[model samples]
Target: MNQNRVQASEVAPRAGLADISILANASLTSVTGTDMTSNAQGNYDLALKYSGTGLASVGVADKKVLVYALPAELQGKVVGGATVDIDANLLPITPGDIPGVKVLFDALGVTINTLNAVLPIPSVVAAFNQLKTVQNLGAYQKTLPAVVSADGKTISVEFTQELSEYVHQAYVATFGSLRAAIDALQGGNVVTKPLIDGLKLAADKLFDVIELIASGGSDILDLALNGNILGDMNGTLHTTVSDPGAASATVKAGAINNALISADVLTAIEQEGEAVTLNFPTTAVNPIENYDVAAPVITQPVAGQTQVAGQVTLTQPIPDRTTFEAVVTLPDGSTKNVPLAADGTFVVDTGSLVDGQTISAKVVATNGTYTKDSPITTATVTAAPIENPIADYNVATPSVAPLTAGDPEITGQVTLNQPIPLGTTFEAVATLPDGSQLTGTVESDGTFKSAGVDQLAAGQTVTNG
Candidate 1:
């Protein structure tokens, strides 16, 4: 016989939503009527009341977010034994209230619970043709407000509804395209190239989920109805991590990672950020369908490409690693095959290279394949790490000869002699007659590679390597 309280915000907007329609039909005076009750099944239901032209359009938001407990049917759910419902009738509006005002309420007494959203609240694919339009490209460039406002109130508990599978696919593809570049944004980590394809697959799998949400969100983000797209996203769960030995992991798409990212990851440049890891009770994570877009793709350059190093990129949605493959056809009709670096990247030394001849680039990746006719790149190679630029081995030795990233770029293996000073208990610095540089991460047994051995002073050799 206990009663729960639920209050609706008057001036709040949906979060992360850019464009939408609103439906306002009526207004309300007060929710003074008190009723103690059950749904005849003896279960408590949370009841809401409102009036005004708005009432006709105010569909309920999801009370139980994905990361949180179930809605009404599942245990540990928000409606936990209590039933929440909404009722409405016309009433004259006051000074602060409008012609159509809504009142959200909750009540309880029952025991069974399952998470069923009030509906209209939650839930993409691709084509190269659509890439031509600026508007089409901008469709996914929405800047969902970190927080939104409506009628004078801030919306805290909000979620994105009206998600499209096609759009989701597009976003995923785009992300996959940029998978290699993502490394530049996130803190340095050894990401296998395959993760890019996995992310796209994940994004594609979201179509089913998009359908589920689209079917139910009849009035969720309609601009004609609720003027603001932002929802009252209160008490929404964001992350889930589980022990590796669990039987299964029921990680949902919206399942958030409070530790890694939140609403912030939705960006183009992709600066330093975190990852969202989900956990389930099972040994492997069960897939929860969701929607996102697939980014574009650009093959490398051609032979006659004016001396500039050409590159390939992607934009995928999944966080798993992926492999990317590309083929280069030389001017003489010979083809040179290449694979992405450890983290889905590839590099070519164009230095001793020539131009003015037609060349082509071929790419076959996890998602699909792309071919560029007569593509061209240049012979503009940047300086690799400094080679043995250190001096004074007799007085003071250095930690590393060339101290920068992107050298020995593929293996990440380095070679450095004992940079120790006096050569007593510590290792001795190898002094070459020519005087160049050398060094990298030395393993327990004392073996490493120099950073920029590729571009070095002629005739300088390190005994360590």
Candidate 2:
């Protein structure tokens, strides 16, 4: 194979990525093939190598490493009896030989074939610029020059592993710019409230993804850089469109238009040094206006409360168009709904809740446009403490004189085994010989007094138990 010959293909349209209107495609060039003599297995191998000389020329920094190949030419050999495999290698440059190119490969295994297939040089350059400008990575930029290999003569052909950090940093910086732009727009109240909220939420999630990548290290970086994140997000969003046929197309078109409009609004804001309005058309078919609404926040009940019932009064009364319901989940796995009053107060049922059991509650708010559910709040059931009854307590016998002849009153002093409780009361009783009984109150000092009794009743006795 000729080392200097680089093949190219006709430009093709980029589907699903209509927003990126950059260099769509490159022109095609003829592949000057070497003698393809088939081996015993009827397979042919093509190998191409690029030296460091051409890359050492003046204005080499501006030269792109990307190349496009037509699929027809690749299929021509496969259509024949022979199988074809093409391999290319880009040798590294010495760091000392180049002035502007500080490190040839940055020890990052970026080959020319990888640049041509996976990533173009223009995107890498653009991402680097964003990292510098948005994240203030001047120190990081300085460290880029020190990542070269010891000899800088050979590089691994895989680009994803090498450019993972580069792409992740670029994603972070780009997300930051987008967040800042959205903040500016929201602060100015330029976009509709729902749209602003939706964009902010999406940006926040993207930020979380970036943070996750930072913590997960290289494997996550490779996955995200290979478009898994975007692809997953696209699949998730496609499920939410009401009309899958025509509405999907309209929604995508509206999204592209809105993105373009947002960019223009951001530019205007930067130029005028002030807030600016963003105007984008909204129709029934293009439901960008119906973004997600934030969930309501509910207060928790007092700890150890036996019942989970409470009156939830919202700060602002819910609008007539909106409806609110409190979903109460019992320990038995059954659910109950509590409707909200016009005044935005909901009194949930607590009869089903029992002591030591837990019940979960969440609020669901819905309008015709959007529905949201609050985070679940749980409360453990508890009951008021019961006082222990007077059990296993001893009492001394009452001391009373034998019945005298005169009508003398009954009197006695009784002792208790345990200390008297604050609300404890004592009573004295006398059983007469006629099978009747008389009772009296006892003072805190353990002294008792009864009604007058005849002294003639000699067999009568008085006791305190």
Predicted structure with the largest lDDT when compared to the true one: 2
Name the Cα RMSD for model 1: 34.2
lDDT digits (tens) for residues 246-283 of candidate 1:
33212111212121223342220012111122222333
Clashes of each: 129, 2
lDDT of candidate 2 at residue 183, scale 0 to 100: 49
Give the per-residue Cα lDDT of candidate 1 at 22: 18
Cα displacement (Å) at residue 356, model 1? 7.9
Task: Write down the lDDT of every candidate, Cα atoms only.
Answer: 0.28, 0.37
| Candidate 2 structure quality by residue, lDDT tens digits, 1-465 | 344343323433333322321112211111223323323222333322211111111111121121111111232222122111112122222221222121322212233223324323343334323433423211111111111112321111212222334444543444454345434533323434444455455445544555665554434434222221110000001000011121111011111112222334323322321111211223323221232323333445444443455444553433334567778887777888988666555565555445677777777766556566766777665555675656534556777655565556777777755765556678888765555667888787878777855554555544433
Give the Å shift of residue 333 in candidate 1: 5.7
Candidate with the greatest TM-score versus the true structure: 2
* Residue 273 lDDT, candidate 2, scale 0-100: 18
